[model samples]
Target: MEISKQYAERGYAVIKKLLNQDEIEKITIIVDLIYDRWLNENGDALIEHQLINMHSLTHPRYFKNNKSERIKFFELIAPEQLTDLIEKMFGKGINFHNTQLFFNPYTNTKTPYWHRDLQYSLIEDSIQAQEQNNILSLHIRIPLIAEKGIELVPGTHKRWDSELERNVRLELNGHINSEKLPGGILIELEPRDILIFNAQMIHRGNYGLNKVRKALDLCIGKQHHLLSGFLDRDILPNDDEIRCISNNQWYVLAKDIADQNFAKEIEN
Candidate 1:
């Protein structure tokens, strides 16, 4: 089946062997290092917050002055193999927003509950429902380990959530967010596979399916008013850093969009 067809019908799509073992190994090394650093620094906060994932894997702070590794990280994350895929699927002008590294919580090891990504944002729910198709928020999930990955509600990206979905996702009236929704699709993925899903679709991670979970998510999106300004400039390579790096299209586009959006703020 066509990737776009699967995406349109199911609000998600999976591509097989998108990264070879060697490629996966390089990414995992850095991811592992970053996770260790994060766990050391935020051990209490993460456990206290009960958060299972950490964002901004590219943030300079994580590299601990290891400029070479950080530069390598940026390049690896934007390989043409991935960028070309995104352009083909969603058309041009997509930009890197941030990154997320997912793992089971240290104490409870429970997966996050199902919910659409954007509802937690400041954008009103009514606007999100109205402009669902016009927006292009996506989570390009790349698992570093094989596992039963995520469960998503089909076609919910194009339509509002059902009442049952609303109750479960929002944990309304005693319904837990992790409560299983009817017809949810559990996408099993291997290390080399890629799962591209609508960020606004109802979904949750499947942490219990695997003992070790280290998935890297590239938060990519086309520039939209509703989603702009959330990007951090520090994640992009500096001018000197960008020159030596190959596969910088995503960062270039991200920096350009961030500049445009911030400029608009001053102008107004």
Candidate 2:
């Protein structure tokens, strides 16, 4: 309905009461299990695995690993109730881009700079493609606790940043205080609320200090989507979580997109 239009115009939409309390309880059980693992072990191995696999450019202090754990995490998320809404927003050819489980601690409350998801190398090409084709991709963020976290500048998705904004973002290097940033819109969400935003929009988080600020950032896109540099370019066919969520139609579309990107690499 109006949610899709609002998302296009403002680059984000907040769906209140999107998940009932019962659903939230079920999801929280899984989340707590993962968090408990991190707490008990301090997740040294998980962190080590991520450091080895991740591009050097990314330096996330906290994240969730364990494929089986992630499978359970996504299993709760990929139900038709959510995918159906996403498909309606962007039409067919949807593919899972990536999943991020953020656990920003109070000690490391400083957050990254305001930036668009498009890689710097791909920015110009992405802008051109968006103008020509209306390619809309987004991050569906589900906060497990009430938090005033995400901050963004509305309509930033449709326009490049101003000189001042760019300079500020560059100088701060993702360490600036989010609330102090000019023209920032702070989005406060409750436990069961859903906040979906175009990742292309300039945004950053305000780290929560009271408790472990936790959220799930799930990226989804149409076939021609360009995403952040951190994304794994290829989705392995044997990935159990992906296969569980995807049927034949979804698999074919995802495979075609992955193949096209791979072909481009070989050609270059």
User: Which model scores highest in TM-score?
Assistant: 1
RMSD of each: 1.6, 5.9
Worst 10 residues of 2 by lDDT: 51-60
Positional deviation of residue 157's Cα in model 2 after best superposition, in angstroms: 1.0
- The per-model lDDT (C-alpha) reads 0.86, 0.62
Misplaced by over 4 Å in model 2 are 35-72, 106-112, 119-135, 172-179, 208-210, 225-252, 259-268
Runs off by more than 4 Å, candidate 1 = 109-111, 265-268
**On residues 1-268, what C-alpha lDDT tens digit does candidate 1 reach at each position?**
8998888888899999988898899999999999889889999988787778999888888887798999998888777899998899888898889999987776654556998888788888789889998988999999998878678888898898788998998889899988889989888989989999999988888777778778899999998888886888887777788887887877888888878877988899
All candidates' TM-scores? Answer: 0.94, 0.71
**Which of the numbered candidates is closest to the native, going by highest lDDT?**
1
